[model samples]
Target: MGHDLNLNAMNYFEAVARLGGVSKAAEELGVSASAVSQQIRQLEQQFGVRLFRREKRRLILTLDGERLFQTTTQAFRMMRDVRSAIVRQRENRHFIMRVSPSFGVRWLAPRLKGFLDANPGWDLRVDGAPDFSDFETEIVDLDLRYGAGDWSGLHQEAVVHDFVLPMCSPSYLAELKEQSGDPIGQLLKARLIDSVKTHFRWDFWLARHGAMGGRMVYPLRFDRSNMAIQVAADGAGVVLESATLAINELERGDLVPLSRAFAVIKVPTYWLVCPSRHTNRRIVRLFSEWMRKEGSAHDDKTADMLRSLGCTIQEEESTILNRDIDDARQ
Candidate 1:
């Protein structure tokens, strides 16, 4: 059989091997089960080898099948990468940025309209998730990372320093005040929602406020800070989170600080990171400067808000200025 004629059969066989059953492969390929089976059989005949073995209704790939699958997978991935590169190169006006989901949704999304309005000639594409893009393979131009700004082979600039405080819904706070008369004491006794990624725990916050040895009651843990913040805003429980990430809720009067005490975790600040090669690019420089200005403005606003609430924003020594950029460049 000609190689061109066997291409369709190979595709059907690959799908069957990957999906582990003929019916599943057929459903995925939008074809009938019998048709998929027939194509697999034709491929086997053409190659003069059995590609899959059926046992207990499960289709397992044979050695030949595994080899072919590996080759096809790499080929498809390369094709996709090539196509993406071509598309990105053809569109010279778009700026690709990557950021964590919480920052993207709570902070950047709100201010994006202003940025776009100010720069109508430029188009923005944001990829928001927990996963950072690999610049070697992906066409990511800028990354907003929550870290110590010490990543090797990248240009890093500190954008925002995070300060965390105990926050809860306003109604919940009112209810606590009305019930126990001591809102902080009532909060310590109530359910505590926490993020697993928090730099400091409730015990740390309690200790800083001289309320040590008071254990949090019925703690609920979430993987993301935004999830805990959302749950706290819905009056589920008190949560310890960055004031920066909860700025929207605070402004909307959905969440209120439970106390006048806060802890600044100096290690994890929002950093603007980009490939060394792209650091000198005009667009990267423009975005970095804009981010710095916006971040500084937000810090000032948050500080003012804290003062209004009679909360003393704790000052933590930051290594942002101490870091030797000379060593970083090397």
Candidate 2:
């Protein structure tokens, strides 16, 4: 056995072990499959142990491989943590935040310019993805997550409670006005735009409103709620989505509510989450305060808008865990 193992080969082996195949690890590492295979072979020879056994085209890790993987995984994570900490300390004026794509596009992206303008010296990096940020190992300082606001081992504050209802373009509604006497019935008869990714399913909304039995064919299914909303605004079909994501379009007269019946799915509230230890960071604290303020303002405005539309706003039990401070030292 070699006295010193190659760190690079160990990394390749880790990637293969994590991904469960040489080809996948190669793609992720941006190297050829043969290259990754060679590295694994080198590592096994160096360690004097078989790391993986081939089984039905998949790389199955052996007992020694599992032990080595455990060590390397922790080591890489620690390395990333150390690197992130140093970079953050050096770039104290920068803040990294993560949010789901739909919220990022429809809600936060439009408001980001104002936030940046107010804090001229601060640099913000926003990542838009469905997955939550790993605060312990990743560089993300804060996250806007859509969930129950009950994630364990994290400091969380509810940013917004979203209520979903049927919405469609004015042109589409005008077209359907002659066909059906009931508004809900018209919506059910029209082409439906469904979001496959959201917990607020069209079936659930339909069943709640007593229209589940109606035979409606969804021609288009989108993975993102924002995309579904856009399709609805284009007069393509009727969509059921969060009012928060459609606020701008609705206010702009691009879309209108189809019915007064709305469902407040309590499981998917937007939350401002961060590691409990990082809540004390100056930038995190400032960003958290700003988000809470914006959230409150949006909620108030949305409630007013709903009232004007004669749509019932179903309120969820408040999940806000923090109170606004008169003065927070940045």
Candidate 3:
């Protein structure tokens, strides 16, 4: 039997396998589940093997399906990259950079103007999301990430080390002052906005001041650090966030350190992470250099912003501590 496999069938089958079901794959591809199922069946007929089996009304990939799926995964990824390359040429304005959401909002977004203002001809498209693994799949040219400089199969360049601390809106601090003498003491009585269980925590910071085990009421428990920071600015609670995330707000007087009680501590830092394959790319090199200067100097800038607000930071300690607020949202 001469069976010719259709490219569309292979595409649909690949999406279904990657997404675990036809329904999900259809949603991702903006199609109908029945359409995906028909395509998968067509692929199976072409290959002369059963691709899937119904297990309690759920599609389960057969052994043949598994093998085909593996091959198709790489095939699709390569094709996507080729497509991206073509798109890149047509959009020849500047670099397309990918960044984690909080990092982009708190750090890169503000600094972007300076880069663009200096290099008027270099166009940049910044893609922000929580998932770092998508860098390769999404064809991101560069990444500004918050981690321990340990991204597998990628070139990682240091930007700045980070630390976590308490932050609240300046208005919230003012109101607390008018309401009570000690706002930190008052906050201790209220909820401390917390991220889900992760590397950075309030216990780490609180332990420095010998404070612990306070009642926590999550008015909002957001998985995204950026959202938590925004809610904190809305006077939701005193959020224990990264200096990196709060830098802009602190500088803008939108969010401020809860009180002198807050102490900055050492935590994970941001890195200019990207595929090592493109290390020599001029734009990537330029962006990485700019990131190092901007990220490392975050402390100095935050200190200046803090000092201008009459918040004296101790020089003996690393003032304006930077840290990772890349919380895993569940």
- The number of the candidate with the highest lDDT is 2
lDDT of each: 0.76, 0.79, 0.71
The C-alpha stretches of model 1 lying farther than 4 A from their native spots are 1-91, 178-184, 207-218, 261-268, 318-330
> How far in Å is the alpha carbon of 266 misplaced in model 1?
7.8
**Candidate 1 vs. true structure, TM-score:** 0.63
Residues 1-330, candidate 1, lDDT per residue (tens digit)? 454557678778767766788998899889999999899988888778888888886888899988988876676657769999898778758789999888888888898887777667677899887887798999899998875666888888888777677889988877777767565677656678878665456665565565644474446898788899999999988888888899778888899887554433333478898888888777787788788889989988987776777777656644542343222323
What TM-score does structure 3 among the candidates reach?
0.57
Q: Report lDDT (Cα) of residue 75, candidate 2.
A: 92
Which one wins on TM-score? 2
For residue 190, model 3's alpha carbon misses the true position, in angstroms, by: 1.8
| C-alpha RMSD values across all candidates | 14.5, 17.4, 16.7
What digit string (tens of lDDT, one per residue) describes model 2 on residues 194-308?
Answer: 9887655676566556676645447889999988999999999888787788888888989998756553332237899988888988888877788888988888887777678
TM-score of each: 0.63, 0.65, 0.57
Better of 2 and 3 by TM-score: 2
Worst 10 residues of 1 by lDDT: 321-330
